[model samples]
Structures are given as C-alpha cells and as structure tokens.
Target: MDNVKKRAAELLKSEAVKVVIGYTMGTNGKPRAAFIQNAEDVDSLIFNAQCVQNLAVYLSKAEIKQLGKPAIVAPLNVLRAIIQLASEMQIQENELIVLGVSPDGELIDFQNFSAIEKYLEDFNMEVDAKEKETLEKISSMSLEERWKFWNEELAECFKCYACRAACPMCYCHKCAVEQNKPQWIPVAAHRLGNLEWHIMRAMHLAGRCVNCDACHEACPKGINLNFLTKLMLNDAQEEFGYTGVTLKEGNLLSTFKTNDQENFIQ
Candidate 1:
C-alpha cells in the first residue's frame, strides 16, 4: 500500500498525471474508487483484497478524461480491459498511464502498453477452477434443463442494469434497452424481457469479455451473468484460438477466416 501511495504521490507532484485513480476506504469500510488530483491526497490510496473494483471503467468518462493524462492504479483485470479497449480504439496507449498491481500485491509501473503486454506474459489467464467446475456442470445439463435453470435465475432481475454499469467493456453511448425509437427490447422487467436483456448483454460481450467478473459482482440479484460471457469466451478460444486480452486487430465475431468451420450450417 505504501508503495502505491508513494508512486501516486510522485506522479501527482511531478504533474505527470492530472489525476490518479485508485481505491480508498468507503463509509462501509470497503474499498471504493478515489480520484486524487493533489499529491497530499495520495495517502488515502489503499490496495488490498477488497480493492476489486475495476477502475478502467472511469477512463472513458468525459469528466475523467478531461482531467488531462490520467493515471490509473490497475489490477490484472483492469490491465486486460485496457488492452482490450486499446485494441478496439476506445483508448490510446499514451492517453493514460498504468500502475499495474500483480496478484502477489506488487506494484509494477508500466511505461507503455507494450510494457504491460510484456509483463503480462508471465501472468496466468485461465479461468478460476471453481468457476470452470460450475460451467462444466451447467454444460452437462440437458437443453431443457439449462433453459429452465437460466429462466429461473433470470426471473429475479428487476432491470436495475447494475451489471451493465459495472462492466468495463460495456461502454456504449446508448444501450439497446434504453432505445425507444423502435423499442428493440422491452423496458419492463418481465421474465421474457429479463431473458432478452441478459442474452443481448452476453452476446455484446461474447469475445471481448476480459473475465474480470465485475458484472457478476455488480448484480444486485446475484445473477450469474458472467457465466454467460465466460461460456462464450470458452467457445471463442476453442473455435478460433483467440483470447480477448491481446493486441489483436479484429475481434472474433467481426473478422472471419477461411479455415473457420461451419458445421452448424446446412
């Protein structure tokens, strides 16, 4: 924690970054996002197991970007989000600086996106064992059983959109749910509406999900929306040998290869 504060303070004092995005103690004694513009406020920065919120979501905020050359204290997940965002041209490498934190709680000051990519080479990108086991269990279920399970789980949704808000990759200017021109999706939180909303969310994040699990964590109804995206990610890897956290040009769904199998096509 001390090292993080020191580095943040140095960046602020030197005017290297107009703002340093980090974590601080909230009213509930949990870690929350903190924007430190002054060097003196750097002491409030804290990093621990509770500091799981991905600060990368703030990078696209108009107000935050106006702060001028922001610096983010990023975890591995946030770093992956950064890479994904960079590949999508949502953000630039020189626009924001990254202060990466390793799994062992070590602070790694990355000079650029290339540095981050090189550093992440040694990091493991596998899904958690427990999550994998749960996915396997669901995959083993019959089609009707899986449908019933998902319908039951999604019935609890109240259209709060907490998952969408917390997802770093969900940076759309206007979501399909909010569109009223044709009302592509129903606004009501009925079973069908909820199911459609989740399916749309999962499809949008298909090959781009960084496996941060922020959506799952942000769900107020404890809905396992991350599972949907994880399943898609697994399929993407198996079918195309593609991973989201890379400097790749085109996404899985956007670009097609001649070698791609079309066994499902009639």
Candidate 2:
C-alpha cells in the first residue's frame, strides 16, 4: 500500500497526471475510493485485499469529468474493466495511466497490455495457497448446485443499490431501472423484481465484467453476486477464446467482427 501511494504521489508531484485515484481507510477502517489532487494527499492512499471497490467506474462520471486525465491505481479486475470499457466506447484509450499489482504483492510496471504476458512468464513465484483452495472449491460446484446455493443466499436481499454503486463497471448515467418512461424494472421489492434486476445487471456486464467481486461485498444479504461474473469470465475464455484486455483504453471488444464465431445462437 505504501509503495503504491508513494509512486502515485511522485506522479502527482511531477504532474504526470491530473489526479490519482486509489483507495483510503474509510470510516470503519475499510478501504474506500480516494481521489488525490496533489502530492500531499497521496499519503492517505491505501491498498490491500480489503480494497474491494473497483475504481474504474469513476472514469466516466460527470463530476469526475472536469478532473481530466487521471493516473489510476487499478486492481487487476478493474484494469480488465477499463479495457472492456475502451472496447465499448465509454472511455478513450489515452486518458488512462494504469499500474498493476500482482496477487502476491509485486508491483508490475506494465507499459501496455502485452506486458502482462511477459510479467506472467517471469512470475515464477508460488501462487497464494488460500486463493487456490477457494478457486478449487468454486470450480467443484455444479451449475445447478451453484444456482441453488445463491438462491438461498440472496433470499434476504433488501433491494439496496450498494452493489451497483460500488461497482466500477456499472457506469450508466440513467440506469434502466431509474427510467420512468419505460420503467424496465419495478421499484418495489420482490423476488422476481430482484431476480430481473440481477439478470439485467449481469447481462449488461457480460463480456465487460472484470470479476472484482465488489458487487458481492456491497450486497447486504451476503449474496455472492460475483458468482455470475465468474461464470461470465469462464464463458469469455471458453466461448470467445479471448483473455480479458488491460485497463488502458483502445483495445478490442468495442468493434464488431463479422468473422467472429456465433454459431451457438438460434
């Protein structure tokens, strides 16, 4: 955390970018988004496993717009979200200054997306044993079992938008649920309404989700909302044969390719 903050402060001091977006200790000691306008503010920035919120969602905000070019300390998940956003025309490629951190706490001075492969090749360290165990458990579950598991878990949901608000990928200015003319989703709380909301949200994320798990953490019901994103991530790898892109803008996924496979469609 200190290393990242120090580097970010140096960037701010040099005027490499207008702002540095990172995380800070929140009211309850949890990590929350922190926007650093000057070098002095960088000392407050933090990074940890608990820094769960995806900072990517701030790139497209109206108030954040005036801040201009930004040097963003993005989680690997949020980096993928930025790449996906570039593909979707939500942001420009040149506007981002990204730095990556490895799962085992190594700073990757990646200049571009291709550097990720080089990093992986040089990364000979052992994977975190606990993360491997969690992945193994998640992999062992059958789809139906997983669905049933989440159904039981999400049953206590109170329809709070905490998950959406916390996510970096959910950046629509006028969410469909908020539309009064169409009212695509009802405002009242109900199982069906919640299910539809979840479905729509996940569909919107589809190839764009970066698997940050912020949605799950923000859910008051303890629902594993990110389970769907994991499923989507698997689908992206298996069906599209495309690993996710990096956070820098102007990669792929925004433009249509006629040669792309879609035979599964009816």
Candidate 3:
C-alpha cells in the first residue's frame, strides 16, 4: 500500500499527472474515493476487495479535470470503466494514466490497462454465490416472462436516478430523462414510465457496462437491475462478438471496423 502511495505521490510531485484519484478508507473503514493533492496524503490511500467504489467514475468530474491530466490507481473494474468511458469520448485517452493493482495487494508495476486486458479472458469469474443464484433464476425465465417480471419489479421505481447515480459508466452531463424541453420520459412513477426509464438507462450502457453491480446496489427499492444488463452482456457477446470492457486499448464499442457485422441492428 505504501509503495502505491509513494508512486502516486511521486507522479503528482513530478507533474506527470495533476491529480491521483485512488481509494482511502472511508468513515467506517470501507474503501472510498480519495483525491491526493500532495505527498502527505498518500498514506491514506489503500486498496482491497472492500475498496469497491469504481475509481474510474471520478476521472471525468469537473473538479478532477481542474487538476489536469488525471491519473488513477485503478482496480480491474476501474480500468474496465476507463476503457468504456474512453470509447464514449467522455475523456481523452492520452490524459489518463492507470496504475494497475492486483487482487492480492501486489503492484503490477509494468502493466498498463491494455496489457492487463489481453489476459482478462483467463480471469473472468462468475459473480458471488448469491448473485449467481439470482442471475440464474433471472436467466431461466422466458423472454415474455422476463419482460413481465421486470415490468412488475420496476413498478416501484419513482424515477429516483439512484441507479444512474451509482453507475460508473453513466456520466452524461444532462441525462435525457431529466430534460424538460423534450420531456421524453414521463415524470409519473407508474410501471410504464419507470420501465421505459430503466430500459433507456440500460440500453445506453449496452456495449459499455462493466458489470460492477453498482446500479443494483444503489437501488433503494432493491430492484435487481442487473436482470436487464446481464442480458445485454450476453447479447453483445453472442450477436456482435463485441465482448464488453477489458483493459484493452480499444473497447468493443470504441471504434467501427469494416469487417464488423451489423446484422443484429437490422
């Protein structure tokens, strides 16, 4: 932990990056985002499974941009988040630096995000036991059944945007549903309105979701929002052969290749 902190501090001191966005222990010792301005604060930064908040979410924020050329002490999920964000043009690729860390607290000193991505296929694991069970139950449902299930499940939503707020990939400066000029989404929190809002949000993240489950975790109503996203992940992989986020230089949605298939769209 100290070595990672020292390296981040050195980067800041040398002006290699203007700010280092990483994690520090939160109020209850849970991992939380920490932005280090000077070397003195580096000791506060730490990483572990408990450091669950995606650090990539903050790289595009106004305050972080003011610091200039942001660098992040990235977890695997955070690195994936950056790749997805970069593909969307939310942040410039050259302005960021990723300090890769392993699950066991070792520093992958020489590995950039791209290097880590190439090997991600071998490391992909299923979700936790309970989440896996939930995912399985959801996946087993028929399409119409699943549609009806989500409609009833999301009926409780009040358009709170809690799911959007928690998602690392949902960084739109002004979300469409919130706009009054177009008034695309109804303000009423009925099943019809709620379902459309949720669908729209999930579709926006189709090729980009890193599956951190932050959106579901952020849901106050306890809706398992991953029901929609996980389905999209399967479709993106199977139909388009566009596997989602990796630490790779170009994410599935980042660019268009002439050889790519568009049959799914038609």
Candidate 4:
C-alpha cells in the first residue's frame, strides 16, 4: 500500500501523470474507482483483494482522457484488458502509464506496453478448474438441453445493458442494441430478443474477450453470461488456435485462414 501511494505521489508531483486511477473506500465500505489528481491525495489509493473492479475501463473515457496522460493502478485482468485495447488501437502505449499488480499482491511498475506484455507471458490464461468443470458439464449436455438452459437463463434479462457498461472490451461508440434505423436487434426484452442480444454479445467477444468476467459480475439477474463467452472462446481456440490479449496477430474473426475448416458450411 505504501509503495502504491509513494509511486502515485511521485508521478503526480513530477507531472508525469495528471491523474492516478485507483481504488478507494466507497460509502458502503467497498473499494471503488478513485481518480486522484493531487499528489497529496495519493494516500487514498488502496489495493487489496477487495479491489476487484477493473480500472482499465476508464482509459478510453473522454473525461479521463481530458485529464491528460493518466496513470492506472491495474490488476492482472486490467493489464490484460490494456493489452487487448492496445492491440485494437483503442489506446497508445505512450499515452498512459501502468502500475500493474500481480495476483499475489505484488506491485510491478511497467514502464511500457512491451514490458507489460512480457511480464504477462508468465501469467496463466487458462480457465480455472472450477470454471473448466462447469464448462465441461455444460458441454456434455445435448444441443436441445443446452438451448433450453440458455433460454431459461436469458429469460431473466431485462435489457439493462449493465454487462456492456461494465466490460472494458465493450468500447464501441454505438452499440448494436442502441441502433434504430435498421434495427439490427429487437428492442423489447422478450425471449427471442434477449437470446439475440446475448448471442450477439458472445459472438462479438468470441476471440476478443479476456475472460475478465466483468459482464457476469455486472449482470443484475446473476445470469452466467461469462459461460457464453467462455464457450465461444473455447471454440475459437480449438478452431483457430487463437486466444485473446495478444499483439502478434489480428483478431481471429477479422482475419481469414486458407486452411480453415468448413465442415459445417455444407
């Protein structure tokens, strides 16, 4: 905690970063996003197990960008989001500073995006045992059973879009759900509309989702939206040998492969 405060103060005092984004105690005594511009306020920065919110989502906000060269106190998931955002050209390496925190609570100050990428190479990208087991269970079900499961889960959705708002990867200026001219998706939160919305969301995030689970965490109805994205991610990996949060390649869906399987096409 002291290291975080000291580094934030130094960054602010030297004008290296105009703002420091981190976590602070909220009114309900939970860690919430904190933006500190003054060096004296660095003491408010806190990092611990309670600090679960991904501060990386603020990087592309116009108001935060207006603050000028902000520094973010990022966790592993946030760092992954940064790498994904960088690959997508949503953020530049020189535009922001990253104070990365590993899962063990160690603070690592990454000087550049390259350093972050290298450091994250040792980080495990595989799904945990519990989630993997759950995914396997879902996979074992028949197609009809799987369809029924998703329909029942999605029926609780009210089209709140809280999941979209919470996801760092969902940075589109105009979300498809909000479109009206062509009305690509129905606005009503009926069964078909809800199913369409979630399927679209999952497909959009297929090879891009970092498995942050922010969408699942943000769903008010406790819907397991993460499972949908995870299933898509698993298929992407099996079919294309692709994963999210990498700089060496373009998005899997965007790039075409000559040897790609077309067994389902016919």
What TM-score does candidate 3 get on C-alpha atoms? 0.82
Per residue, candidate 2 scores C-alpha lDDT tens digits across 153-250 of 65676778888887877888888889879778888767667777888887777666666777888887777677666666565655665455544333
Query: Candidate 1 has which clashing residue pairs, if any?
Result: none
Please give the CA lDDT of all the candidate structures: 0.86, 0.70, 0.74, 0.86
> What 10-residue stretch in candidate 2 is worst by lDDT?
119-128
Segments of candidate 3 deviating more than 4 angstroms: 110-113, 119-122, 125-136, 142-148, 246-266
Q: How close is candidate 2 to the true structure, as a TM-score?
A: 0.76
Pairwise lDDT winner, candidates 2 and 4: 4
Question: Model 4: runs farther than 4 Å from truth?
Answer: none
The model with the greater lDDT, 1 or 2, is 1
* Candidate 3, RMSD to the unseen true structure: 3.6
Which residue ranges in model 2 land beyond 4 Å of their true spot? 1-3, 104-106, 112-151, 246-266
* TM-scores for every candidate against the unseen true structure: 0.95, 0.76, 0.82, 0.94
The alpha-carbon lDDT assigned to residue 42 of candidate 4 equals 90
> In candidate 1, what are the lDDT values of residues 1-266, reduced to their tens digit?
67777888898899989999988899888889999999999888888888877889898888888888898999888998898888889999888889888766678888789788777667766666798899999989999999999999999899999888888888988888999898978999999899999999989998888888888888888888889998888888778877457776567789888989758888
Order of candidate numbers by TM-score, starting with the best: 1, 4, 3, 2
Please identify which of the two predictions, 1 or 2, would achieve the higher TM-score against the true structure.
1
Tens-digit per-residue lDDT, 1-266, candidate 3: 66787788888889898888888888876677888888777888888888777777777677778887877887678766766776566766577877877787666663444565564555552344576577778779999998898888988787788788778888888988889898888888988788889889878877778888778777888887876787667666666676556543354555566876665665
Best by TM-score: 1
